[model samples]
Target: MKRSSFFSVSLAIAGAAALAVAVTAPASAATPSAATPDTSGVYSVHPIVEKAGLSTSAVTPSLTPAQCLAQTAGRVACQTPDSIRAAYDIPATINGVPAGTGQTVVIVDAFGSPTVQSDLAAFSGAFGLPTPNLTVYYPGGKPTWTGKKTQTGWAEETSLDVQWAHAVAPGANIALVVAANDRGATIDNAIKYAVDNKLGNVLSMSFGEADNLIKSPNANNGQTAQGVKALAQGAAQGMSLFASSGDSGSDNGAGFANYAFPASDLNVTSVGGTNLWAGSGLNQPRETVWGDFANCPLTCAFGVVGETGGAPSLFTSKQGSDVAYNASVYTGVLTYLGFLGGANNGLYFFGGTSAGSPQWAALTADTIQAVGHTVGNVGQQAQSWASKGLLYDVTVGSNTTPTFSGGYSATAGWDRPTGWGTPDVNGIIAALK
Candidate 1:
């Protein structure tokens, strides 16, 4: 979703029938800077907290929408326990159940983060959540990558997804199957890697690119049908694949497009984005809503980003963004990105359906643990009325901006950007039956 000096072709985003709406943008919105990592700490802001009830402490800070782009660009990296609680309606004291000692959830992503283990500890400790079954599987960390800068975006995302899911569903065994890079054959290999190793039941993927040309093995397309067939055999063994629909929408981030991969695969669950409003300690009836943003067209100053380029999906619709959670920059968790220019140890905000997908995966673990069942092929049940109603059905608000042609507005019924809304922990557990 790069934004530095940009321009985008005005796509009519015709006849998706299910989701076309009029587009809008701020009056004075400048063509956003190519949306990239915030080397400047403008987006490095956090909620002001204290040893007290909700105050200015819980008050979410503000940054221009342009400054917020980096948060979702990588992977939804700042997913903290509190965000999960509001987004899921899981009780404050999730220690009610035993740690997920036997169940399993495997996270597949690019690269690895150095502080994954310690960060897990801090997140779990702060909220009194259970410590989940956790392990890492990289086979090798790619002796080539040191995991610096651009690599950091995807690497940190991988760490946050694996750890947060494990923390929320502590009793579940969590394994991380790592890939060497964010592009090329590496990601495909990572997915196959997880499948080959028999990492069955509940798998998660948080990134990818698009291949608009009719499928070609060398063109970075999805698993070949034969490959998909083999994966289906794995799914028959009760394995479920979950992937982020990508930061870009249906147009493939060339402004308003969506990317491919496991997300595009019919056999997998495609998680989407949402803007959620949670009352940290408000204690009133909390309300949940859908969140999706529109992208701006490309401009010469900031060219269409490679990751954000490529054509629309060749594959037709699948059931995903089968579900969603808070992936917007404003309602996201806050953390500290490494300080730049030896300035303040910069604090920042981050979230994307990247954060939400793993959150859903972890909730599945908790439900599996609670009900003691491993109902695979969750994609079907996920869209059922039982599951849909169990979810929060985030129904308010919509993304309005000039850059994007495809509108991500929330209508009365289901929307493209966020499928069946987010999960309602208690209701989701009940719906599992």
Candidate 2:
């Protein structure tokens, strides 16, 4: 799901678990402004919000990057695959191999996109990238579409995961395992299938549920236990695993501090969110912990904006996020999707830690190529890199929201929100054991 939808879903989960926090609007709220090039150093564009009665089937034509900027006065940064690669200093080839040439990345999602293959091809062609070695699998058989909004959201997510993972590591093979549904056990079953089949050396899960909710007596389904077992098996076999921490700031939309499950599990590397400024001319790339706390009126109340989840877990001593990546809707990356129907088959800007996880998994593919073998459990390696000043340290911004006062802050070293910080991919590749 996109971050906005996920926000409402997380809050709904919290409500079901009796962890929902009450939100009260302040008397005089400030509306968020459009992005300013002078301050942010990137051309900005805002999303066209779907109105109450608008149809999503309208034929929205694709726009150029320049057109994207000129079309809106909203405050948001737009990025391309080339710009992201340049920003991170990721090499086209690691060692003698073209980045992820021999590796594979497995993406787990529910209700996979109907048009992902074509969408991925279009995305690659638009960005001058090679066609990916892609395959899609369904553990519980292909899902019959009900045309539900949730299904559409998952389809968008599927496109984002498949496209961006390939964008980051164009040479890697991709294995997309579609779950029958979003149910805990069902999702776990897909994961178990991937592990049993040895689908890939790197895996990414771009979804998560609230930690407290997963552990609640009324909600625990043994799914977390089953997921952990499957992930542990993958780890033992040298697969690097990743999951998005969440998109609802540190409190995770619960009105109090909590963490997201799967990501909260110590076995997985929890990827967090950041606002990225890919440098141009004289400006250097910069990042900050992703949060829109101060932009509360439309951002917080509607939960349509983006925020990174980073806090100590209610279930474990481990932090919720181990590393961060660009995830601000205000600073989102471009994605191609044809599954929206009608003329909506075009490029759109998307953000969320969901964008981060697949890219991280792609980075792991390169890491595997560089090291001549798979490296499991990147969290420990990332910590070691941070200790050596090898990663990009994000020391600004906070994940606190108006309702959740106990939210975590970004700090000099390892902190809850961004953990060791964003990856300097090349530096990490060089520093890998």
Candidate 3:
């Protein structure tokens, strides 16, 4: 049976759960701004109303480090012990979920961040995050990136994943699994390594090549299959894998549910993006939803202006997403890129579903704390969204693809882009058991 969508799928949580309070920045040699500020600091971006309308509140506005730390408590996890990134948010202790402390989260990425320690520390410091559960290693101890163009990009991507996951689940230990290359096999093996070793209770991956996640073998077979199976094995071992659905939207590769590698493995969770929003309640709330207009017909240029929804995939298995969180621009994280050479670059601004993937991973840690169990069977667990109050109903937005199928417009119910809507962290905790 080819399940067409994840909309009507359902599931259940067996007990009571709750989340503990939880919880970036800047500079450049750069130019004068006609705008009020350059916004190259993590603390500057306003809280989002929605990430492609997937969640109602993604960003937490500007909070002092003390406040963020006070909120998360033991869950103030981080890849680095930096101060800049900590001010944004880092729960002091990931005490809510049933997993308790000492659990681990494996962050899988394409390359290495030599300065991961320093950058993460800065990220933590700025956001007021607690020190990470620690223990990081490049797969084989030294991954061979070959210094590809994408290496640096994925490096920053890696930093974001580990730093944020730690911030949200400070009490949880983090194991970063890196690969020699981004193309194939090696990365897959890294996933397996995490699984085989019982490295963590949750796995968060941000790299993908934009392919049908489950159906295709991608470029590297044996290794790829090993990775997929590893993730599945991890799931069976009581771990949840959070894979980033790509930032390109439906237009990625062939468009519509075009998952990249592990995200589409069917065995793991294929997390998509949504326009994240935030504010007091609802009406007239300060919000920012997901949008990425690919170049096409009426519009010759692709940009962040029109694609409010997100990419979709009819190819993905039912309940593919499980749930979605903020992963868009406008409500982006500000930081100093410096001038190249890794974290020292003049300045940098990061957004995309990459940020949301780990945030969800960390939240799941909290859910585990509250539920007393690490979430397995992501598809089944995510289905809990249908339980009502489990998620913030995403009621708007759309993915602007050059050739979008169906109506593709965002509406009141579940659609391709923002599946099952955003996580009601508190509600999820309450429902955990």
Candidate 4:
């Protein structure tokens, strides 16, 4: 299943669960903009909203970093930038050099968020991080908001991408390029515009379409063809493209084994998900492939049985995922989403590979700052890092489900669920430097 669609289906199944505790919209709640169409059926924005046990009357009040951590008892755990930095062993300064001072990370999403700037401001203020240099561009055209679920979903995704990218590399400039719609051409044009204009060195894509949708009898769709060319051009020009593997375990939502496009495309670095557990003060103690079915409410709102996307690619030359991150919503990152409107305002928890891609992009910006040059073809760079034993290999967990015919499990080295596992940021920076 493509991520956005997967989340939609999950929400439908758990609609009752959400309603039981969903926060009530305010009387003056802003009307959501029009929904983005799923033209490719594969390019859905990836942000799994957890609606269980939420208040129905008012937005959760702002919480200090300490307060947020204190509420993590049988509730969704919200991570701060300090915690992520500590968990990943990311240094305050790398090689006596600062991180991502002048570098820019470009985030590509559909139906740009109307309040991304304000949302990012809230997020930085909450975490006490410096405000980031940010810009938003509509390469194809301004999105048409039909007041559909797609619009709101992508708005959340935009918030997740911008906030976390800045969270990881606070000094990096951010350029958000939103496609007019989810149509393949529109998205490709947005990406090409970013590349042609040299907007940023790292491009973070938190959306994907199923590879099977573009293969065989449907080959003429030309959905992924143009995007592939643009990504290749970006890579050749010393840009790093990062995409989420997906939210679906292995099934393509049509009950067949498949991988997500763009991420499946070899030119991009496919980031997978992981179950990350941190000790007191956000010290990372245990990390594994993020296949937690029992704790679905915390990580996913879909009926239990959600897993990280992992499998052999039926569409591309390279394997599925190249790196992993703390994508489990149970232990998800906290980001502000002012665009949601009403009681859904303030900090919210987000999971899925959608949360991971931008984090990796931020990490890439940090790497570029450390190396003093853009590291082109991040997927290839991941391979180099893996060879030098720089990655934390996850040897447990499986993405298999009785509902899906084909799936992969985490193994000794590169397996489906966790690819080369998560990166050791300090090690990656040291090795690349």
Candidate 5:
């Protein structure tokens, strides 16, 4: 997610205090910025890693919410695939067959991860998920990686996108579409390639820029417009699209009602973030808008102030987020990545709207399998599902940050922060049929 100049200054001050705390910890502990790449270009984009790098020496399989809180000293709560499925009422099988079979999920990212296949295999083996038929395609040609922050950061994004999508729909095939670079034309053209080739039933884009930047004549150069065209083409072909609303809150750090493009586009389903409270064998899970001030638990400890990007679009009348999922750094999801090399390889907790995109794509695959056909627009179906109580309505919390005081709040039905709240997966499947 992109940040404005004023928000950067605040993060810098908070980051300084956070560095002091890290000085007394293990030398291998990485700061939030170091672990998560900040690829904030006007046209290009980056993944949203709400927390810093907390890698283990070996694969730790999965961590319970209580275990994560204990391990992180009450700083964070984590969830596994099983817990997420239970919280959302996701089924492992449908009609006595593995769910999401005979469907495909296409995940698009820039600078594909080097060890995504091996890492995904490890993650699946650890969690007992079936190994998906995975394929990596480079329409713009394979990118070279010298282990730069730009490439490595995107690599981490690829890992998270691939791993979690499979976690939600293990029986589905996965296609990882790699854009050559983070340039405006390259990434947008990659979406065109995926659409032209008829990649899959769902397309997941976990990147975006500020709507103000996208609308700027000097900044965007019609990049987002081209992306919208591609997405529209895909939708016409019966594809469901999902993109991250953003992690910088409604104003997008611009001190105004700024939104993120691609997500703000009408053809795409915009996914927002939430602070999910589940696990410990709870019958029902609770959630709130993913807005962290200086008072949040683990986020405050690391000086990370994140909120789900939402609000009315600057370009159009569309709301930024149509649905939401778990995205708070305080209650993040676990992901495994060993391609970073050295001590930076292992399990790490990640948060942000970026995490929600691919998982929603997995849900799309599940819906496709359940209905025996593609659900043309997930947002439209979800909007209709809202009245049927197929979604969890989140009426509490706001996306206000210190930088943007006028951020929108989560409302009764469909507001900015969390659109229709998080998914009730089983209910949605039943409604789809």
Candidate 6:
């Protein structure tokens, strides 16, 4: 049976404010920039709840764009691993090749998930994918959930990272490194630990703060220094780091163009988001730089002011995302997060650059496996491949918010919103080869 036949039947179901500051001090007496806790301290994780209610009986299911965006009986439609592979033109097997068989993809997050292993087992089983050789490491210490918001949020983020990375590269091993706390210093320690231990060749980081926030008067230089050092060390070890560009568009809740940190760091491949439409079986897919500005007027929570992230950077010349994938809640991806309260043992729809980062890392694992070795610099390799037309370039849409005029729009080539655009796995593999 063609999976496309079920696409329509499956289709029926689916689916912040800030303060100002005063500057009255002299130049020398000016306060040092402190990291903005709202934007820079902890990464933003956006979970979309069905307007109806949460369900425990619904298993993880894949939905097409038509089914996911429908208003009536809005089911939790999200892209499944197979749907993603099909949409991106990734081969079921590379030349009957066992790509990523022995490779490792490491995921770093704060305050580990207690049910990650079990949750992953269920996700893989539902999809008929192999169980990953997974290991959870806590460099600081095991997280004490204590029902804290940060802990719970990280637990959800951890599940998204692990499942999606495995989904993209089912053969690769995964190392999940969890920080004891959500502090910049604690997360930095976890990253350094991963680098020092040579945990993996590709690392996916879904947590980040706004770059401008980190440059605030209260910013911690020590934490920033440590983060920079860790990136250098990871690169030196042949590890390719990937971080989410963020979900708050350009404003980042600051009513201005504020880029997310770590993502803005030069050593990392910053991934943005997109709205993907997987065409029928064997039909070509279509994608646009993810922005929901047009649909925000009546149905949007933030009205018509929301968008994906893209802005100038204070840290490096690479000003925006290197690539993108489905990150909008309206065109979300499916994952199992049964650990959350009120979430039955069912699947949920998730969007944001958080979803994009891990999938990119997983694809990188495939590239490494195809090349039979880790690329010295995955970010540079991606650019080179993109130049050769190994990626799908998105030329439509913009990540513009109502108040921020500084955001970039998608154009013919690399733009701030989606740098080189989305990946073409086969083309990338061939280019890397």
For each candidate in turn, the TM-score is 0.69, 0.82, 0.69, 0.83, 0.86, 0.83
Model 5 poorest ten-residue lDDT run: 4-13
Model 5: runs farther than 4 Å from truth? 3-63, 216-220, 280-285
Instruction: Please report the candidate that would top lDDT against the real structure.
Output: 5
Model 5 Cα RMSD, Å? 6.5
Tens-place lDDT per residue, model 5, 1-433, is 7421111100111221121112112223221231122344434344544333443322244556756555555556677788788878888887776777888899989988889899998788767788767999999999997777467678878988999999998888999999988876788888999999988999999988776665542344566667778988999999999999888776766677878778888889999988887763233238778877522544354455477888888776677689999987667777887876775566666777888999999987887898888888888777788999998988778887666678787888988888887888889888878
By TM-score, how accurate is candidate 1? 0.69
lDDT of each: 0.49, 0.70, 0.49, 0.70, 0.74, 0.68
Best by TM-score: 5
**Per-residue alpha-carbon lDDT of candidate 1 for residues 173-230, written as tens digits (9 for 90 to 100):** 7788766655435555666777777764677766543434226433443444434554
Off by over 4 Å in 6: 1-77, 95-99, 216-220, 280-285, 294-306, 341-343
Tens-digit lDDT string for candidate 6 (17-128): 1111111212221111223444335444443322222232332345344443343223223477778887786655654644467788899988878889988888888776
> Which runs of model 3 end up more than 4 angstroms from their true locations?
1-100, 144-148, 212-223, 253-257, 280-289, 294-320, 334-347, 403-407
Report the CA-based lDDT of candidate 4 relative to the real structure: 0.70
Cα-based lDDT at residue 124, candidate 2: 78
User: What lDDT tens digits, residue by residue, belong to model 4 across residues 1-433?
Assistant: 3333222211111221221222222233121122223454447765866543232122232332234334433344456687788778776555554467778999998898888898888777766667778988987778776548578888888989999998888888999999988776788888899999889889999887766556532265565677888888998888989999887676545455667778887788898888776533445436767765422434233344246776667766756788888887666776776765685566566788889899989988898888788888777766678888878878767665545646777788788777887877888888866
TM-score of 5: 0.86
Per-residue error (Å), model 1, residue 298 = 25
* lDDT tens digits by residue: candidate 3, 1-433: 0000111101111211111331111121111112221111110001111111101122232532233223323221111222222322233444543232666767877666666776666555554556655667666557654545555566666666776676667667778887766545667677778888877777887655544333334434455556657776887788887776555445442434343545566766656565433421224222223544522111111123223223434344542344566554333443322113632332123456666677777777767776677767554565466556566556565554554443244455555556666666656666665
lDDT of 5 at 252: 64
lDDT of 4 at 221: 53
The positional error of residue 8 in candidate 3, measured at the CA in angstroms, is: 43
Instruction: Report model 6's TM-score to 2 decimal places.
Output: 0.83
